[model samples]
Target: MKSFAFVLSILAVMGLAFWAYGENYKTQRALSEVESLQGQIGQLRETRAVLRAEWAYLNRPDRLADLVGMNFASLGLVPLAAVQFGRVEQISYPRPDALPSELQLGPITGAVTVSAPANAPVPAEDMLIP
Candidate 1:
């Protein structure tokens, strides 16, 4: 009986050893994958920095002015003038009376109720204009 118990314990130990071996490989695979992802992240950060530098170089004001001057005749491009701009009051805003009945908000509840069909297009009269 004692010999049988010793053999059983040895088998249990072997089984546990096999499980630990598999777990060790799994941990190693996970660590390798993490390293690969870190490498990709480093590459992307480097690429982004290079792109930002290139963007800054391309957007230099002097370079843009030179380009504009070179293409002025063909592009018909002209410099902006203060007189070309319009005053805020020059904008023609929609009147409140122009809104449809369905778009009007309730006086007491202040909730909007649309009488139109569910799939019907809603008017933009109630929307705030920038």
Candidate 2:
């Protein structure tokens, strides 16, 4: 009976060792994948930095002015002037009396009608109390 108990303990130890070995391999594989992903992220960041530098070089104000000068006869491009701008008072905004009764600031009383296209899907009605 003592020999049988000893053999059973040995089997349990062997099983635990096998499980530990598998877990170690799984951990190494996960670490390798993380390293690969880090390398890819570094490459993408370098590419983005290069692209931004190129964009800045291409959009220089002096280069744009030169191109505009060369193309002015065909493009009819002209510089902006202050006289072209309009004053705030020149804008025609809607009057308070012209608005619908429901749109006016008041206590909530009934359902509000929202205009939508005929083919548009209708949403479920929700009541809003002020």
Candidate 3:
């Protein structure tokens, strides 16, 4: 009976050790897979950035203008400044109303400084600061 119990105890210990080893191997493999996926993700992100830069370069205004200028001679459309481009100030404001409109009011605000009432609670200096 003693010999049988000792053998069974040794088998149980061996089984526990094998189970722990398998678990460690699984963890290491998962870590390696995670690292590999991170590298792939980084490379793909870099590729996407490069593609975006190229797309911007292709759609640049100067390049499009050059292409249009090369092609417009065949179209025979006479482009003028008023048609092709206009300044914001020229478009936004008319000649007659160049100056801002005169604000009509009850003359509430006066340009010249006036003295406050002698009995005023706050002095003019204190009121100005506040």
Counted clashes in each candidate structure: 0, 0, 0
List per-prediction Cα lDDT, in the order shown. Answer: 0.84, 0.85, 0.75
Identify the candidate with maximal TM-score: 1
TM-score against truth, every candidate: 0.64, 0.61, 0.51
Better of 2 and 3 by TM-score: 2
Ranking by TM-score: 1, 2, 3
Model 1 lDDT, full chain set: 0.84
Worst 10 residues of 2 by lDDT: 121-130
Look at candidate 2 and give me any clashing residue pairs. Answer: none
Taking every candidate in turn, the Cα RMSD to the unseen true structure, in Å, is 7.3, 8.3, 11.3
Q: Is candidate 1 or candidate 3 better by lDDT?
A: 1
36 in model 3: Cα distance from truth in Å? 0.6
